[model samples]
Target: MPAVGFSPYTLYSREEWARLREDTPLTLTEADIENLSGVTERVSTDEVVDVYLPLSRLLNLYVEASQGLHGITEEFLRKGNGKIPFVIGLAGSVAAGKSTSARVLQALLARWPSHPNVALVPTDGFLFPNAVLEDRGLMTRKGFPESYDLPTLLNFLGDVKSGKARVEAPVYSHVVYDVLQGQTLAVEHPDIVIVEGLNVLQPAILPKDGETIPFVSDFFDFSIYIDAAEALVERWYVERFLRLRQTAFRDPAAYFHRYASLSEVEAREVALSLWRTINLINLHENILPTRQRADLILRKGAGHAVESVALRKL
Candidate 1:
């Protein structure tokens, strides 16, 4: 580690990071990118070649090293425990394009023969049901730390790390804006598991009794935080809302269907209002503070394109 005043990360410009790709092949096509992108976002092949390919290479190396270490530990203990999956925690603000990043990575990482069974699990599934939030009077605080089922999330991670044959994570529906009952995403023994969410990197509160507390990030073999200027993220959120108003929000079954009939100006105001009252508050109070805790940070600029990468020095 560097001295206290020195930065822990080695900052890389877009060009500088692209050079790290070396001879890594581009396995994704334009159609594949279109399928991996978010509703209001599009990930170009250049972005995949320049940004994600190198990341996939780095993660492949890390997974190989981790698997070797796990094997060594098992041999030393004279126990033949099964292979442990590399758990990656991905965090970012809403509309920051972290979902696209997660999907892209899942596709790219799965292409690597060493870890073909990569799993992508979003933490939105761990959020308390809408009814539970309404009863707790936390409907407006939807993305806040308190709005999640922390114990369930923690147990799920623990089971995954323990090499369980299969672990089920609750399924959340963006259409209904709630956790779906009797629905669960079954994660079979994957070689790598990418867990994405808004507050995945948030630290646990310490108890006065000095008890051990395992945070969601504690199980991560590596972690990434998608970052951008507050104003930029807000703009993306509003843009996404406007697009959704014309699309998903028009569906009668969509949870935000009421917003579909609003005038453009009215929709913009509502989007800004939600940002100010809830999303912005969560970003400031919880999300932004956890950025430095990530092993890697992808900073986005205009058009939701990643402008820079900061990787913590090993």
Candidate 2:
């Protein structure tokens, strides 16, 4: 790794990132990037635009590089060999805005000249369905590492890496808070595939005596973690919940319809209570600890703008 003084790695303020964006000649703009990045506040923070643009550019470069490696491998193996998809993993806390980052990076990176057919697969699909968790008496431990289908998730990554044709993964619905029954997503041959979730970078949870299986993070060609202070994330969680209550929950068909009729004070209190009881506990217990393992970390300030980017020395 390059010494800190000379390293290409940067951790810059939102204003500084914005300045960099303005100075750059190769600026690529996304449609409604603000909304796409979940920047609800009315401020010109460059967390998504500045730091993320460069990061997306970097990932695009990696995709192209992987293609070159694939070509070399294909030539070595002769006619029968097929190339596996390049996989990138993204990790972050509940309201750190990594979901928006995943969406932005998916669209932006796909639009890049290097790799046009990038795929974005979220780990939510790999979560045990709410009913399944309830059946197993683990509903309360939902976001903990144990709640995932670890072997299945590992196998999915393995299959993707094995160059399988037309691999399909299950679909999960946030509105229903369950895995959609019988709904699967087909991931065809793509130059790049990004996997995003809270615990993608987490190490394996296995018995000491068992045969060691590669954790999901083992397949990551590149990884990113979106980060913020716990208090900040808590605030965002509450705010997002409030917004959802007024909007999505208002629909009679919505799964959280019970929250829709709540008054502002009641809704706010419930949102805070939920965060304190569930999400915050999960963050402290499972999520925050993985921040150090990320290849890249996008650190945000109090206003939800990414204040700096930290790249682990590879």
Candidate 3:
């Protein structure tokens, strides 16, 4: 561990954190990792062993504790074992590799015998449809908090935490860049639910009537924020954009199909412009502000490799 500091987090080097994975069995193969990783994001089995195995163990400890606490509280209230899902929130910038983290964690946590049923929910599904955003004139601010249907998202999560069964959420399509009409994702009873988004940790907005509304983070049993330098994130975003141009953007059905025909220089210029005008603004104004609210922070270095870990002090 690094020397104790004045910060509320205890920092550990990658070497020190990897040791915490002692005796934790590795079940994922290279193919599994490749399938789970996002475009332009590199995640090796070695990275999983060093970074995520310890994270899984830590999450298991928290889940067990939360289950026990829920039992005691329910007994005190004269209720039955309703089995509420343990919720985890993951927040990060656009190219900070949060999707890969959520998928990897879902895969690893499901392998634990104690919690075989895990569900992953990307909050993109909660975003308002493009049509709705256009009506509100928020198309340019798509990833901002205002673009989401906060009431519906809050209700869905509240239902999950209340042990409600068969709760459904709208499904968003990246291919078309809109919420799918008449399509929904059912989140049945599960041992754990991982909610990943850029604004998962954002603070709640006060309504005009001054009635207090619950923030999404209020339901989280644990939260994680993936961090990297802004310059590195910008570079990653540009690289990912270039990769998608040759792959997904080549599909006529893709929302960004127009980018497929651009030359490499033109593609890079477009990506940089988008980063400067939209993504960077969102990162600075919303995402990075909530970093301290996370229970754990994974600091990434070049090549998307996690260089250090900071676990919040109890």
Candidate 4:
């Protein structure tokens, strides 16, 4: 733990961080970025070049160093030690652009020659089925920690870290707003895995007894937290809701289809109510508290562009 009143991270402005890109080449085209950007996100080419490229370079370095260390340990043991997947945890508030960041990182990280086979796994897939949530009357607390199947999630991560050749993660559908029954996403052997979620950084409760307890973050080789001001996140949430109302909410298959018919004013009110009542509470009580636990923090400005980065010191 970091000392009280002493910051553990070294902060860098966008300009300073961009400079760290150095000789890193921009491998993604505008078309690639457009495809990578989330529905409510606008990932400008400059953002990728200035922000993501540097991050890609840094991560490449970390992956190479971790691989080297593993090889050294294998040599010391005088045995053929198989490679373990490097797992990264990304966390943030609902509308803080974590999905966009995760997608961007997946794309950028895959382009690195050393770790071309990178897997992106979302923790949303581990959420308890809607039927179970309704039965437990946890529908209102859907994104809360209790709503997830923690043991299954831990098992999946444990498998990945233990160098399991193939791992299948459960699937969730935003269109239906539920964990899809009998659906799963396969993650084959990859050099790295990025696990993105609202509460991936959440810490496990310590038992008074000295028994061992595992956490989602325990499997992480690195972790990132996307952060923004509460007001900014609220505005972005409403904006995204308004966009969904005009687009996805219109689909009959969408769980939020009912919201499509709402008037603009009604939609705005509903979005605000949901934000204030649900998301804000989760952010305050759960997400924000885990921000400091991340190895890196990306602080976004008003336009969802990363304005600064805080990297924890070695």
- Which residue pairs in candidate 4 collide? none
Clash count in backbone of candidate 4: 0
Model 3: per-residue Cα lDDT at residue 121: 92
lDDT of each: 0.94, 0.78, 0.94, 0.94
Off by over 4 Å in 1: 1-4
Q: TM-score for every candidate vs. truth?
A: 0.98, 0.88, 0.96, 0.98
Give one digit per residue, the lDDT tens place, for model 1 in 171-202: 99998899999999999989999999999999
Residue 152 C-alpha lDDT in model 2: 83
Better of 1 and 4 by lDDT: 1
Candidate 3 structure, TM-score to reference: 0.96
Off by over 4 Å in 3: 1-5, 206-210
**What would the per-residue lDDT of candidate 2 be over residues 115-223, giving only the tens digit for each residue?**
7778889888889988889999988777778889888888888889988887888888777777888998889987688999989988876969898878889999988
How far residue 162's Cα lies from its native spot in candidate 2, in Å, is 1.2
lDDT digits (tens) for residues 1-314 of candidate 3? 88865898999999999999989999898899889888998798889999999999999889888888988999999999588899999999999999999999999999988788899999999999998999999998999999999999999999999899778988998889999989999988889999999999999868999888999999999999999999999999999999999998999999999999999999999999999999999999999999999999999999999999999999
